[model samples]
Target: MLVNMKKILEIAEAEGYAIPCINTPNEETVRAVIGAAEELNTPIIIDHAQVHDSLIPIERIGPIMLKYAKEARVPVCVHLDHGSDYEFVMRAVKVGFPSIMYDCSALPFEENVEKVAQFVKFAHAAGITVEAELGIMASTDEDTHDDDPEKRVLTNEDIREFFTEPAEAKEFAERTKCDALAVCFGTMHGIYAEPPVLDIDRVKELREAIPDDTRIVMHGASGVEFDQVQNAITAGCSKVNYYSYMAKATTKFVADKVAETDGKIAYHELQEAAYEFMKGYAKDVIKAFKNGK
Candidate 1:
């Protein structure tokens, strides 16, 4: 069933698990992600990143995502990920996305709050859920969503500067009235320069301070250790954004499969095999985020 992101996240928060929010820029990935959720009988969120507009415009993929979501056996939320620009976010809304991340974290705190608060009012009136980011999330070279190459070299130490303050998180959530708030604790986007260490305590603090109606979100969960990821979920994160590593792994898997087949596999067959692999990969991700639930 197709549902709003807030509906699924409320359930996740109450059930002591986090929903895995994965980027599905293409048809294969969309099918694979929803297929995994159906097999596990769990709710999943499949998002289209604004950065991927170059690859496939939302106009082209939005209906397809919604169609798949409506047909899926388990609940699925079609979301707009990292929609920084107002016009781009409106585009997602126009395309009928049930959830949107109106990221203005790069702006001053007051400006970010004002922008999101205004959007939240309009979004709520339309019965759409809005997610806002409180802190700047660093990105690595492998993160295609981040166009700035300088972000790629940021180390764990550098990421600490971007950690969301618990008090500010509460204020932001309260002021904006966002359904979910993505906050930086330790993880950075893409492959980590070093094994990332999550500020589990920070997660707990943010959870306690933030309004109950606003679920806490953790972005850049791809390269973090499973145990740490689960710990964050237990501490408070009800929505975890994961991708970079999964995409990298899929590429390697396809390459290896072609080599094993000695280049004899047909193109369609290769695509099918990749889809199957991603389905299984997404299943493991969902299970991990379940935190043993």
Candidate 2:
């Protein structure tokens, strides 16, 4: 059934489990997520990043997502992720996504609050829940980096500047009136070379600071240590966003299968093969989040 993040996460928070927020750029991935949720009988969030609009236009993807959510036996929330552009956010709202995350974490603190507050007002008026980010997340796509300076490892200075303070998180949630809060807790997006470290204590502080109804969300959760994830969930994180590892796993499977078949399979068949891998990965993630509920 189609649902909002507020209700989906409220149950997660109360039950001491987290729901996976998986991003999908196509029908294969969408089917995998929804199918996995059905098999696990768990709630899920399916999101599309606004930056990927060129590849998967929201206008086309939104309706299909709604169709999947409506048909799925488990609760599903269609959400717009990391939407920095105001016009694109409006388009996603028009497309009837149950939730929208307006990422203004790159701006000054006050400005971030003001911008997200406007989005919250607009979204709430349309009966949609808003998720706002309060910290900086480093770009994880290696292919998008420039050759000049090359990509540097994330530094402690960067973390200290961007990591959300408990008090600030409380203020941000109250100021924006957002339904969910995405906090930065040292996990960078994409593949991690040196292993990721999560501050579970920070998660506890954020939980105590924010309103009981405002759910805590973790970004860059794809490659984090599962034990750390368990700790965070135990510490009151109710939602975790994941995607990069799913893409990597699916692509690897498809490429290996193509090589195994000597490139004779049709494109659609390759996609079907990839979908199988995605479904497996999604199921594992769902079970992990729910602690095998």
Candidate 3:
């Protein structure tokens, strides 16, 4: 069914489980996610972005996602993920995605809030759900550098600065009225060479501090660690994002399957193979849910 994401996520939260916000590029990824959700009989969030569609258009991807979810027995939420551009966010909503995310993490905090507030207005007015980010969640894809001439790691303060108090987040919701919040919790995007660490205690504290109804989202959240995903879910995280790993799994599978010596491939030709890989990974996540809390 074409269900609203806010409702599904809240249901998952209250029911003592988290909805997997799986990244999808094409039909195979969607199918994989849906297959996993259906097997688990759990809610699923299928997320996409313009950055992702650098090859596959969102317009083509949207209907395919909606169709797969509608056909599935479990609930599904097709969400926009890390939307770097405003136009793509609007386009995703227009294309019938139930939820959209505005990633202003690159902008200064004040500017991020202002920009997110404006986007929230447009999204909420259209009866679509909006997700806003606070705190800097660095990823290899975006800004992550050192001061001077050395590479450095982000500190706890840097992570904390990206977050607003639960009250402030609630007020932002009241003012901009975003439907959900994505906070920085020490996880970086792309891949983590030294392992991704999420402050579970801080997450619990933040969750306790937020408004009861506000959904907490985690971005730069992929290649989910077994313990962290479960712990975050226990700590009031409703939506858990998975981007790089799943896409990586899919892309790698497709490349490995291409036996052509010419190193040439067509889109759909590879997408089919990629979809098979995505399905297996999606299934792995669902099975993880089954085995885990």
Cα RMSD for candidates in order: 1.4, 1.7, 4.0
Kindly state the number of residue pairs that clash in model 3.
2
TM-score of each: 0.97, 0.95, 0.82
Candidate 1 lDDT by residue in tens digits, 23-120: 99999999999999999999999999988898899999999999999999999999999999999999999999999999999999999999999999
Model 3, residue pairs in steric clash: 135-162, 173-177
Q: How many collisions per candidate?
A: 0, 0, 2
Model 2 stretches with alpha carbons more than 4 Å out? 147-149, 155-158
Worst 10 residues of 1 by lDDT: 141-150
- Show model 3 residue runs off by greater than 4 Å: 142-170, 251-274, 289-293
lDDT on C-alpha atoms for all candidate structures: 0.93, 0.86, 0.72
Better of 1 and 3 by TM-score: 1
1 versus 2: better lDDT goes to: 1
lDDT of 2 by residue, 1-293 (tens): 99988889877976789999999889989999999999888889999988678897999989999999999999999999989888888898889898999888889999999999988887888789999888777655664454533454564345555678999999999888999988987777766655677878988899999988678899888888788898888898889999998888887888889999999999988888888889999999988888656
> Model 3, range 93-147, lDDT digits (tens) per residue?
7789888888876777567778888887777677788888876675555333434
Query: Could you tell me which residue pairs clash in candidate 1?
Result: none
